[model samples]
Target: MILNARSSYSRLLLMVVLITVIVSGSSRAIVHAAVNVPDNIRVAFFINLGANKYQSLTSVATLQSTDGMNLIWRDPQFSLPAGNVAAGNSVRFAVDGYRALVLETADLNAAIAVLKKIQASSSAAFVTRLTKSGKPVYQVTEGTYSSAAGAKTALTKWTGSGVATGVQTLISARVAGPWAVETGPYSSAYEAEIAADQLGSAGLDSFVALKPREGALEYVLRVGQEQNESTLPALQEAVAAAGGLNVRIPAAGESYALIRHDMTLNGNANKPVDFYAIPAGSGAVLRADPAGAGGINLLERSKRTYRGSMEVSVLNQSLAVVNEVDYEQYLYSVVGTEIGAKWPLEAQKAQAVAARSYALSSGMGYNIAHVVDTTLSQAYFGIASENAMAIEGVNQTAGEVLTSQGKVINAVFSANAGGITADNATEIWEGDDSFLTAGAESPDDGPQKGLLDWYYVALSSGQAGYIRSDLLADSGQKHISGAKYLKATAEGIAVRSKPQVVASVEPIARIGSGTLVVELDKVPENTDYSWIEGPVTPEVLLASINKRAKPQITGPLRTLEVTKTGPSGRATEVKANGVTVDVGVSDNLRGALNGLKSTLFTIEETGRYSILNGQGDQVDSSGQIGSLKIIGGDGTASSVTDPNLYVMDGKGNLRAGTTAPAFNFLGKGYGHGLGMSQWGARGLAEQGYDYQYILKYYYKNVLIEKDA
Candidate 1:
């Protein structure tokens, strides 16, 4: 029968409700609040910074009141000295420096000490004072102010008015009821009724009553009896179940109803109709004829039409069953009768044969029947079976064929033409004689078929026949290869210019350590270094040559000069004897020059030089010719005079009293020391370190794994 959209929706809803009841054994319940907060306190602000750099400041600081007004700065400049400030110190900046300094205490004592310290310091140029009536009032004592303007005016006026005292006031507010709940009171009966209706619609019951308080009549809307005692638990459950649901509850004996002017159903304004159920397990059948006298006129109304459709409600034993009469069949039969043709003959014969076979298969002990639409050529045969062989065979056949063709067939029997295909064929082996064949069509023509021409016959449980072949396309299976690790030596030894870029000749991976890597289609060439091609794999190798070479240090040569002095007696007479020799001198000069080797020294060539003994007395002088000695004298002998130059060791250690160029490579750490050190890694590895352990040591506590 043809059903309208509204009827169909109602039927679906009925089915859903029936299924829910059968599965869960209970209907869903709505939740309402039991208690709510009363006082409306304006939230100044909400700070949610956790235990971070700002948490301590917010927790320790307190808002202060001065002149009967509470004052709290949104961004007060306050700090405690880094070393002195403990975890929870209430601190504020006085005229002291910008650096955080600890407060002596949380009260006026600390505030006074900080103020006095600021006043004594010469660097503090700003004056601290209280304010009264928008004017500065200096205070002989120190305290927190209620407001910026008040503090300034009080301080200024105090200086002129000679007020040396201030009072501190603190405000504490208490919260009542559920801190986060919102509630309202209802005064009108109409409003309460509306609220009740809303709550009832939400599956929650609400009541309305008069709350007599101090002889005054007050209407109260309360959650209905079903939820009064269990409101809190139910509310919590509902919130946990479906995120959040609005809830409300009234005081004892005071009924409360929900406010529902803005209520909606499943988020939609329009409400959906409720669905009713018609019994299906048992039903009576329509007989072919009715007796004349006591019998009712069954045929006349039995085949009655309802808006081009018909419905039959039957009682079978204790069960009531309802079935739709195929209107299409009735129309077809009427047309056939008018034309005087045999249009219904085929369906009638098929049903009769099915009924007889069903009865025989059931051992003739139980009743069997056939419900048929002759004109539409469709029929349903029901039977009581001992073994159910026929039903089982039909179910098995249909399941196998449909599953093999990847077609989904519903459990119930129904006639559908769209799912039939030429490659998927079906034939009835027992109970009925029928075969289905899907008509062939070109790809461009699409499918050209009719429901009447495609027949399905059920024999056993879930088994049926259908047109076969060409129903499903063939799909190929895929084969996957196993993972493999590849090994290869570095073509040449060189150091990478950068970590990834090969520079000059440098050592690559160790000689015997086999670096497992994935194989690639191509190798990078003439590009400093080649990547592993793919992910590095694990493989054992006896040895691997370094891929990069170390860089050679090449530059201009540096020159260093050396000088020696002659014996004190010989050098002193050079000018007097008029001797000018640039070659070898005496044993003392040779000894001093040998000692000066490997040491840097400054040489001063004075026309005349006086040699002093350890006692600081001049012993001899080189006159006219010249006198020279190593800048820093030999360790055992003193110099002829004070020297300007000093020598330095390879480690840049300065030699006493010598002028020499410092060593070129005298820095801390080892290697180039600019980036990660391979030597360091080797050192760690030699000390029994894993790859991840090595990486963590060098890169701080960072993790290393496959590059996901």
Candidate 2:
């Protein structure tokens, strides 16, 4: 039994060693390279469905990767959202983890052969040649394989090449594997990925791959996976990122090699290519193979055709050691003060780009080194050089003092200089100078002729006067055809009707300032006062007026008398001063009075007239009445002393008891009370008050901060 147990233990130990080796090998494979596939990959394609505009469709093509082969095709029957599918339009498709390939044909046999050819090529050689329509086709670089049978098995699952039999064939080719191609020698993988993503967005599948020649990994972008079709456009955009073009592709059946020939030697042997980095300040400088060597062989690697270049102006550079507080303050001062009103839109955009670039590159930790693009010539006043330095990351805010024209000026608070207000006569002015005045009498001696200080002059009816420039109260001034009136009290009041009692009432003239009045006649003694009709009362009635006196009425008054016909019926006989008067049944007494109250009646017998209440009970009466006072025949009191108010026509003939429509005074402007309008802020700014002062006066308990 002991021998058997030992044998079993030895077998268990062997199993453990095998498991350990497998786990270690698996981990190492994963660590060999970092996958450069983006989490979110976007792709688009150009397709032609048919010739007729009515049936043609440019739809998004679907893509997928199985094993080492990538399949790409369009579903013509696929229905997309309405208005999304258009003829001759490009369609965009996006997917994560896998790259996109445009297959030239749906034929499985042709694609398998192409994959085999690519797999056989060297690592540096990514492009493969294919024959389409009996013509040799050169395409984007792809992978190579050892045998044609192996390639066929891997690509057998794909639905044959989708290319048509006759037309020039073109399609995307996607391959699986970490294929690496040199895209300039980048120091960081992050930079390589950035370039790769840019190329991928342009419909080129690329990634960071190891280059054994350099002993350092560089970004290698592949156009197609198994098949090589035209990818020159995508490669052009990617090369432009590094300001390179004139790229060369291998010819059909050519091995992986970059040939450099010295044209100066006529037929000299091809030499190895060299690469160099150009300093940022040198504009359009040619890159050299060695650090500082200049030789004619550098031109040997040049490919024919002009490649477009991307120019990024280094307007400003900042040191990487600045703190957040100083950086923010510096930015604030630059935007709020230096470039406040004088900087144009282009300069502002440049400044913003510079700031963002510095923040991103330096990680908000390092001091910046600034370099200005002096080629741009635009005048920016009030912008300090120190502020520019701060933006470029050269100096911190606290350590630098901004000098305007070499002299430091303390921050000054601005005030409201241009505005309109009641204090200044209504007028319009240009920059605190009286341009025009409006409303009221001309200034011979009445008031100031020109605009008030910090006020505008607006002329209504061509009248000139001064108004607070900051208080452009009037959007526009309007005039009433009739004369204007001034009140006696500073606290202006509106009255319905003019009142008698000369010593108690103050008379106001049209468009005139309030004038003090003195009484010259003895006040009349009466319990009631009379109502005057007009916009203003006579000056004689305002003399010695009691400032607080109110209007009252007194006189011999004749009242309308009525007698009831039944317990609940209308009145039968209505008389004024012992004469029969007309009485009409109406909903409102005011309406009935306006319609029939003023009919003149000839008084056959003079007697006191009493006005009965709605219940037919006597309320009041005239103590004594004369024959001429009561003179209406239609039961209306025309000339009765103290007759009820009624309407009259243009002929001055009384219209008995006719109701007149109520009057409405149409008002202008918004808000309660009349003073200090808010819409006038811009006018105030133009007049002279700074924006801060305007806000301060308009809003209470507010503080302005640089950051805010």
Candidate 3:
């Protein structure tokens, strides 16, 4: 008996070891060399789909969702086979509502491959549908229990998957229209069956079906027959866990791979392949043109042709087009659009390196793509706008990326720094970086406008303006007046009256700096180097401030003051009526009131102030104006030369006087003034500074290395 027990124990130990090896090996299979290399980054050219103009999708290749749960085909001459997803038909779910895990991708072929891997790894049924916003997502039902408790229990089992998991209480049957996840139109049924078997082995259940291909018989592998939407991220995690298969849901509508093949242009055929997506519909749609004979308009702002694929999906009730292009190719368009193709070679090279580093570190496209095609990421227009100079810059700095302690750095840059570089923490959100430092600008001739003249004029109706230190007559005493008065009474200080009498006069309307213009020294050659915006009205300021915040503010905006300045004289804290309302990154201050050219400025108001008497009236030289007032001059009345001269108050009230209330923004520089300045780099290059010197000067203690 003892001998038999010992033999059984040895067998059990052997079984345990085998199981451990298989589990560990399966985990490692998910990541292959191709996906691991960081060689190329995916960019979502289109994300917002509400504005999509596509009426339907037409493609020659069969399309499917990422889960291989459904199939869509469009051929004018042929009918769809049984079990295939019919165009214009909505996918139905098992229960009134079901939760699912989804994965999004711009490539249909890749989605199918990923779906097969997911099927092999997990024992869950998946469905495909365009999100309400138009993104085609693959979903797996964690559980279709009668109660939410059952769903929660199933979700708990996915803790090790690391996917975005959630429990959705489906209120009704999800009517996700027919979407497809398909695999090849094999030459024969036997071949298709073999492929299906492989997929089944991988854990994906699929079937073989006959389909038309180029006027011949063909068989295709298809899956995704259910239509229940669950926590969509679960499937993505499952695929990732199974074997690191890359599959993503397409934008809502129909996910398609847009291909622009060889075309005759100017009597010669040129091949520049590109891809796009469209919504799913009927009538030869799957086998038709991407835009249905009408070419889709993409990246309309720069009017450039994109040589990459796009995923069109609906997001937030709007249509978004995401462009997925290679990292180096994207840099071609960005370098040119950002610094201009006409810039110096060295400057362009520096910019190329900086842009590349910024793109990888920004993490803006972590969820969908690597980066956007707008200024939100970097200015990327695609291949159509590629210029020779920009191309040269990218080639020269190929595979170069900025690194700090073996990690990529977030290389940020701007237009002009007004002669001073900003500290990273001060200019942007508070963060310490060894690279960006506060110091004098590199270029000796870097955007210097000198000390410009500023002034403050006073007006009649209690409006006030700024009087320059040079223009001030004397450090005079301050006085209060008008219907509202402050006095030290026996019972503390009393303002206005005990019953709180409402003043008949409205509060002084502080005008924005945009209203007044100050003639100042500036870079005459380039106008954008210096700019002016508002004497913006209070209403406008309020509206703009409210848009960036919540709990909407109420305002007749009384005042705007720069409460703090950075080492470079950049506005760090701005106060609106003694409240610290302006707080955020660099853009907040510039965009606060009708847009200020830069934060290096001082506000000047012009107006006359006086002390108020006990009767709540202006106390003039003689007495209270309402009680016994007499207008008088110092010894002799001063005479004005200009007859058109009118004095205005802080409230915009005007009357005959020597001066009027006006404001001035005496500031310098353009852009956020952080990191490397484009013009500054050019100036440095002109001064014989190489690209390395320029980069080192702007970003201190940084190492330049090839990421390739």
Candidate 4:
């Protein structure tokens, strides 16, 4: 995988002497050990090439390391961060290799002719220049592959008329490395880098590298090439006072060596490089100095920086960028992103513990990684999101996690619960831990005090939901002074019985844009906490019901209503066109509803007619309109309703009796009402509740004891 056009990344291959021992083939025990509280973590920031949050697939990634970048070294048993990622200097890693069957020709024209001939058989053929035995030469090659064997196998079926019988397999790479005399094995890459820089200033090919210690990594300064045992004595002797060793670095392979400045050879972008006697890559770690002074940075991603080092490796056709960070340092960013860093310290602490617990139990990204740096798991935005208070919260609650039955709990959370947390996780996970239990909602002071901001509003029929603040305009205190009302800007929207977009729910009333409605009781302008979505035509709603509901709402959608609700008043089951579709959980209902934010809502109809029964009481004729008769002024009776009917409007104009109803999902909250609600937590924290108390409030009867 191409990480960057030019990039350097690797750090913390080991933690302690024991870790080094494990990595260096001493013990295999730790490899299989379960993760409880990991000292270091791997968070994949770039998945494939286009898989990052930024969605960029550029072949180059630049990195700056504070501890100095380390070279990666691995045997069948271990792979770890080795040494020298320096500060200020940018190290680049890029995807720069391909395997191809090559034919060397002394002349460029001959190579081009051969390339053209092969192109007829394979679309990837190319011609480029290389050096052979001190002479410049041109070569024709074809195909892209991460491994040499893959290219070799492809050569067997050659069919080009001009194909060379003496074809050689070549792997392309951009590389620069040199052999050198080594200095002392310092304790840190920072120390080694300073020494290497002094030599580099004096025009030596100097750099820092790492070697495994018992469980830690030690750094060495090396300077280089053109010197064998006889010629290297002078270079070694100068460092002999510092315990220098006479070391000769060998050529680096494309597997671990990348040329920072070399993307093309002899003006050919696809040509393999000639190392020019320099050591290209021997799996030697070259990196930004992270162990020295400054932090590591992802130069292309808005220049977002990080406290920890990075691991850049090949994955499929693109590079994988993984952030290697201390678990606690990781929380400095995660805690702030999950819960507001400016929020109460207690709330942040709760988020820290929960986030930690969730990461441990989530089993995400396989073992190659623990999690992704996105909300698909949890938002991890690097150092920019870090806050002092949030860091303090992380430090104060370090190593703590929520566990039930002696195991970590999957502490799931969301933005808002619409005043009630769903009680369905127990059903999903098949456990009855009290920590996952939730009770009926009491009162959420968050929306009341306006601290938990939202565009709250009520319709003329006394029904309400949160509206997007941007959609509403202030009434200019038109209703009353010192009191503001929001004027609805658009009309004829669907109002559903549930906030979800599920088709199983029958279409309800359509609220017009100019309908009189009350604005928020607290702040006049707010968020998605309450919203109205649509006035869906029956044709549209029917299609959705059939697509989502099992047993598929088989006919035209006549009536859709919530038939059952969980303890939190979240719709769990509904009937579409009067047919029962047993949606067993609130979350499932939410999923079936085109991923609506919540399931707490009410439905109303605009064109619906009501019947005055014998008791003189009005009954809505929504789904049963055709069953009743009406007495006209002339005492003549006719059928109730027709599909092609017109009626006179109040303005003395004629219009269709039914305008094909649509629905508006008017409800509070922005996520699955499960476990803790971010807004609710903020509200409780404002009410002087500590994180522990808040956790118990949302997650019932669960103890907030520290991890055992």
Give the Cα RMSD of candidate 3. Answer: 23.5
Report the error of model 4 at residue 61, Å.
5.0
Q: Please provide, for model 3 over 391-476, each residue's C-alpha lDDT reduced to its tens digit, 9 standing for 90 to 100.
A: 89889877777777767788888777877887767765667977775675646244433433223333233333322222222223
In model 2, the runs with Cα more than 4 Å from the true position are 1-167, 172-338, 341-708
Encode model 4's per-residue lDDT on 1-708: one tens digit a residue: 655533423223224655767777642111212336878777877655233333324344667655555555552344665434444445555443443545655665556656766767664554544343334455455554444455555554443343664443333221111334666566665676566555544444454554444544466655543213444566665545433433433223412232222123224544343111112223332222366535677875668888766666555555556777888888889887777667777788778877887787776453347887877677888888889988988898777766665567778777777776667643222245567646546234454454333444555554545554545677665433223566767875554443333467653456667655555343322344565454445566666656667667676665566676666676666676667764444455555554566776544333354446779898765656456565699987777554423333345333223323334344567666667777777777777877776766766644444533
Model 4 CA lDDT for position 193: 50
- lDDT string for model 1 (70-94, tens) is 1111111321111111122111221
Candidate 4 stretches with Cα past 4 Å from truth are: 1-36, 47-68, 78-289, 299-303, 314-319, 363-365, 425-433, 440-528, 536-561, 574-588, 603-658, 705-708
Misplaced by over 4 Å in model 3 are: 1-38, 48-303, 313-320, 363-366, 444-526, 549-554, 585-587, 606-664
Ranking by lDDT: 4, 3, 2, 1
| TM-score, ranked from best to worst | 4, 3, 2, 1
Residue-level lDDT tens digits of model 2 in 71-92: 1111122211111112211111
Weakest lDDT window of 10 consecutive positions for candidate 3: 492-501
Lowest lDDT block of 10, candidate 4: 273-282
Best by TM-score: 4
**Clashes per model (N, Cα, C within 3 A):** 91, 99, 100, 82
lDDT against the true structure, each candidate = 0.23, 0.25, 0.48, 0.55
Indicate whether candidate 1 or candidate 4 has the larger lDDT: 4
